[model samples]
Target: MTDPHLDLAARAGVADERALLSAFADNYRAIFRAKVAGLSEADARRSPVRTGTSIGGLLKHLRWMEQAWFQRVLADEPNLPDRPAGEFFPTNEDTVESLLAEYDAQCEISRRIAAAHELSDTGVHHNLGEVTLRWIYVHVIEETARHAGQADIIREQLDGVTGPEI
Candidate 1:
């Protein structure tokens, strides 16, 4: 499928806050989404890197992080159901389609929250004390980008495919 996010990210360059934010989000999105491209249902879930960081698991982790930071923390919604981190972890039951669906849901929820708030809006974090919505966005962007980098390395190690060049 065509990921509008990729296009969106492409439009965002490393300039100002808006562009920077979009760039961060885009890198994160690209890392996970790109890793699964051209892989089978089985290969996508395989921890071929031996680090338990399967492409599926990475997608689930990003989803969990978005919900945790944006929805659960910022909006103060109740924690995401009984889903332990394990649900997102790759097991024999995880499929490429299922992981992508979960990621899409997370992306929708996150985009809604992000659209409604400014980066300056503040929320009380139990650990970090008061944090601005801007911080969360950047934090997620940075964190996601880092993981995406990891995914790039892992994907290459698994199959010889690598880099943004595709």
Candidate 2:
């Protein structure tokens, strides 16, 4: 099957604003996912850098980001559980496979949520206050792309593998 993420780039020239933003967001998400694939759980949890950011942790954090923005902020789903304090690091209970599955699931949910809303639709954030769906799309794209770059570095440090291919 053709990779949908790869296909996005080909169609970007003609994509509307929402589709363009979604394309960028999905591409970065795919890159982040690719960075974690084929790694052992042990390797994924290993922090090569001094900051202690492992591939597993990044995956988990990205999953939380998806839920936070799409479900909590946008959809305003009630009584969502709180995230762990500070930066998220994976627990022993979090396996690489499980993290990947969770991240993918959350991404799918995010996509559906975005699709249901208009770009002009507004959401009230606790601190940001009254942000548009277009703003959220831009925010997610930047955040995911930044984290994906970090993941690329970590992956390269782990095994010299690079690029966004999966």
Q: Judged by lDDT, which candidate is best?
A: 2
Tell me the lDDT of candidate 1: 0.73
Candidate 1 all-Cα RMSD: 2.7
lDDT by residue for model 2 (103-132), tens? 999999999999999999988889999888
Clashing pairs in 2: none
Top-scoring candidate (TM-score):
2
Superposed by TM-score, candidate 1 places the C-alpha of residue 95 at a distance from the truth, in angstroms, of 0.9
lDDT of 1 by residue, 85-110 (tens): 48547767667787777777887788
Cα lDDT listed for each candidate: 0.73, 0.85
TM-score to true structure, per model:
0.82, 0.93
lDDT of 2 at 119: 95
